[model samples]
Structures are given as C-alpha cells and as structure tokens.
Target: MASELIPNAFLASPRSVRSSLVSRLLAAALLTIGAIAPALAGELLPLADKAVVLAFGDSLTSGIGGSGENYPQRLATLIGHEVINAGVPGETTAQGRERLSTVLRDSRPGLLILCLGVNDFLRGVPEAQIAANLGAMLDLAADASVPVLLLAVPAPGASQIDPLFARLARLGQVRIDLHAMADTLMQPALKAGLVHPNAEGYRQIAKAVAQSLRDGGALISR
Candidate 1:
C-alpha cells in the first residue's frame, strides 16, 4: 500500500484548488497516485542531527514563479534548519548530474533533497538517459555518505507517477516522496505556469516533504 511507501502520501493540500470543480478533479486525479516502494534495509545516517539540507533541482526548486520563497525555504522552517537551495533554472538531469559533485563538495549537507528530471522530460530527452543521470547523482551522494530524499516529478498533467521513479527508489538510494510534484503542478490555482508552482504551491510541496520525512523516521515529531 502507499501508506507503506510514504505513509498517507495521497492527502491533497487544502489550498491547491479553489473551485469545487478543480478540487473534485484534482482529488479524482490524485486518487490514481503511485507510491515509491521502500526497499532499503539499512537506515540513513540520522537526518535529525543533520544541520543542513541541500535542495537540488531545476526552476521549480529555485522558486521560479514564487514570491521569493521556494519549497526549500519553506522546508527549512518546517524542518528547523537551513536548506541550501541549489536550484538552477532550465537545468536537465544530465546538466544537474555534471554539477552535483561540485555542489555536494561545497555544501556538504547532511540531507540532499533531489527534485530533478522535469526539464529533461519537457525537452523530450530519452527516458533512459534521464534515468542514468539521476542514478549517477544518487551514486555520488552515496559515495559522499550523504543521505537523500527524492521528490518525484510526474509528467505534466499526469495523475499517476511514472514507474521510473519507483524503480529508482527501489534501488534504496533514498526515501522518495512520489506524489507531491504531481499534485502541486496539476492544480491550476497552485501553478504559476505550465510547469512551475506559485508560493502557496511551494508551501504545499514543503509540507508534503516534511510529512514524508516524519513518516520515514528521518524527522521526529515536535
């Protein structure tokens, strides 16, 4: 069940849609959501004691279309730490993979929240290449002994997440929040444009991530 994967990951944000029609649509669409199976046996190196959280991704993670507050910023408050925003606009997975080592060396964060691959998907990049690049980043994190939390980005307007993210999560590289992006981007009111989200939308994403961490035992309840 999805509860095993993310523990109530299907709950939609209250502010995502305003209209009754949109709300009903969003709710119906997200009902088909998929979970990233928890396949890891070994635990992460205690995320609660970790001081810094590095949020890595493209424009969505950068606060584009948001009012200067991105999900990472919102997440910092929720998690009680600084979340280094390493977001680069228009970046694809390949480019992000190329730059990740340097960012990792510089930030040396205790937790790495990866929210990538959307640009690659939009650019029509082959799925295999996208997967390979994402896998490389995960490998880099493992090599550096840093823990990871993957935020899955579904194809735009898609109700269900692609199986690719689930496959990657199955590798035990990270605990994956498999539905936040899909839910955030699918709602018209929550979106700033076709791909990016507004400020409140980013907050919704942050809240979902915080919840996922709590459920996975990376964060203790306050």
Candidate 2:
C-alpha cells in the first residue's frame, strides 16, 4: 500500500498539469499588465510619415534567424513608419551604452525601441548592473525627448512577470510584455537554434510588438 501511494503521489494527470500551467501564466500576465497600465495612460504619441523609430538590441533585434526581415522591418510596415534596426550580435549592455550616443546623434529618431540584456543575464552579470545600464539608456532617451517602448526579455527559468521591469514602468517608462513570445520561441518549430527564433517566430514577435505599441498608445495610425 505504501509503494502504490508513492507512485500516485509522484504522478499527475497531464491535462490537470497543463490546465494549472495555463492558469498560472494567465494570472502572471494579468498582474504584470495591471502593474504597468498606469504608465501607459499618458497622452498618445502621434507619428508622422517622416518619424523614425530606432530599434536597439542584440542579435534578436538584428534578425539572426529570420529570413532577412526582422521585427523592426515588420513593425515598420505595421505602423507605417521608419524603424532603424541598430542591433549588433553578441552585444552586452555595456557595449550598447558606449555606442548609443553615436546612434542617437545619427538617427535623431522620434522614438526608441530598446530590447537588451539577455547576454548579460546569460553571462552571469549582476542584475543591478544590468538595470543601471538600462537606466542610463533611458536617461539618454529622456534627454533627447525620445518616446521609448522598452521590451522586457526574461532570463531563463524566470517567471513571466519581472519585478524589475514593473519598477521601471512605474517610473514612467513604457514596456511591452515579451514573456509570451519567449514561451513560443521555446518550441522546436519556432526556434532556429537554442536562443534564436525562426522567420515565422520573428513575424509573431513583430505582431506582438506592434499590438503592444498600439495598445500602449505609443503608435497612432498615420
């Protein structure tokens, strides 16, 4: 009887397990959205045809696995604006910080899409340092009066909601939830390698970003 009870305790019904996972994911998403909604309540950012959006990140933003088109390219079509892709493969936040001033000066973009820090996280860089680097980037954008849409990338084994991102959002920064995309990218079909997304996956990411921007009132129809 004791042996039978041990097996029963160790085994869970797949359907019930899936249901519980879905529930948890939904709850996390709701909590994150609720936390950041207030920051998005600001006035809508109107874009002109000539307005430029600078997308800065690592290889994920540089279109590593996609078929020559990345999120920024798809985003440009969705929003009818120019999106300059400024992604460099294997770039750390410190490197990004060093190059950002030149990119900002050259692009002089109306808006900035910042997605970074995955490499830092993977390399065991301290979270506080990562946050500080990102905060400095935000300061640069603020100084230039550039509206920013920050995309939060989760570290492996992390929860769908990130408190660090929530804190930044509360401080008046706009953020897009990328947890769903991260989950999707984990599937073999959507992934090109361990950490990169395929073309279809890239398209889905682009759509998510576009929808988030629209929902956050950061992009208005031209």
Candidate 3:
C-alpha cells in the first residue's frame, strides 16, 4: 500500500474535523490565487513550489547597511515562495546555531541560505569553531533532507575567505560564491560597499543563485 500522507489536521480540533477538511479543500482550490501553480512529480517543480526559503545569517542577510533590498527578500521574488528572514544583525555562527532550533522548528525550510561567518571573522573567533558551527547547522539541514546554499562573506579589500567557500564546495555541499557576487557589487557601476549591496546588487545575487539552481536542476518536489 502507498504510505498514507499524514494530514496536519490532527493538530486541529475533533469538532472541527469537517470544517478543517473543507478548509483544506478550499485552500487547494485557492492555491492558484498566489499564481504558484503546483508542480507534480512528473513535472519539474518551479522555484515557487519549494517549501520554504530560510534566510539564516547576519546583518548582510538582514539587509544591514543596505537601502531596503536584502538578498533573501529579493531571492523570494525571484524564486516565488515564502521567504522567512531569520537573519539577526550582529549574529555570529555560534549565535546562529544557537537560534537554529527555533528557525528549524518554525519553518522546516526546504532551502537554508546560510550567510554567517562575517561576525565570527570580525570578532576574531577561531576558524575551526566557525567551521564546526556551520558544519553542525549543515548537518541539521541534512538530517531533515533540506538542501543548503552557503554564502561566505566576501574577502575585504585585502582579506579573502575563499578558503571557507572552497571547503564547502570540496565537501560536495551546495555553496554559492557571494564573495564573487559581492565583488560584482563592488564594481563602479554596481558599487555599494564592503558590507552590503544595493538593490541592483541584491538582484544580481538573486539572479545568480536562481540560475545556479536552474542549471543544476536542483529544484526538488516537496
């Protein structure tokens, strides 16, 4: 027998079972309202169908120093789904991991866009600890079968964290080179600053990530 997909209704009231069922049916009917047309197993799922896009990181992910466009918010428009911005400014890898349980329990995101490490580097935290915290979060996501897109902080004018980004790649993990993307933002035309990007820069990063997923055929069905 095909395994029965457990309904979330058990969390609702017994007296409301009929109403709950009706509501789900209505929701199914209204699903098209968001223009997020559901993708079936036979069809490739669009970015919109991806369960959740969790933006977990520091200020950059929080849109700090930027005007109004954060990468995660822009990524949502590009990908078409609910983007949960869990970024807290001034957060370090340890703090992020400490808060990971709340985010995981709340969203159960399908994709975790991790943008940490800058604070750790700034505070002169040991690189090994940084790596361990990150690896632990990645493991958490892995345990839940959620894919990750790790974005390392860009090397400052003279300092580069390319080694960290490369490590993620070497591990056969999904990682995006936002450092390079940030480099693009540093261009005279797209210049923002050493820390955050402008709207155009966020768009560039989002487009790059979206294209990466498209190219890799990483969009998965829920």
lDDT of each: 0.73, 0.66, 0.58
Residues 1-222, model 3: lDDT tens digits: 000011122222243333323233223333232321111111112344647878888877777655788777887777677788888988988899888877887898766777787777778886556666776676566556556666656544534343544454323244454443545445545546666666777777677666544543445431
The residue-level lDDT of candidate 2 at 213 comes to 65
Residue 70, candidate 2: alpha-carbon lDDT: 85
Task: Give the winner by TM-score: 1 or 2.
Answer: 1
Per-residue lDDT tens digits for candidate 2, residues 1-222, read 000000111112333332332233323434433443323334336666698999999988998988796888988898888889999999988889888888999999977888887788779986566666776676666657676777777665454534555455434344445443565455668768776788888887888877766765656664
Estimate candidate 2's alpha-carbon lDDT, on a 0 to 1 scale: 0.66
Clashing residue pairs in candidate 1 are none
Report the error of model 2 at residue 59, Å: 0.4
Give the TM-scores of the predictions, in the order they appear.
Answer: 0.80, 0.76, 0.69
lDDT, candidate 2, residue 189? 89
Deviation of model 2 at 210, angstroms: 1.2
C-alpha lDDT of residue 55 in model 3: 81
- The local distance difference test score of model 3 is 0.58
- Summing lDDT over every window of 10 consecutive residues in candidate 3, give the lowest-scoring window: 1-10
Of 1 and 3, the candidate ranking higher by lDDT: 1
List the candidate numbers ranked by TM-score, top first. 1, 2, 3
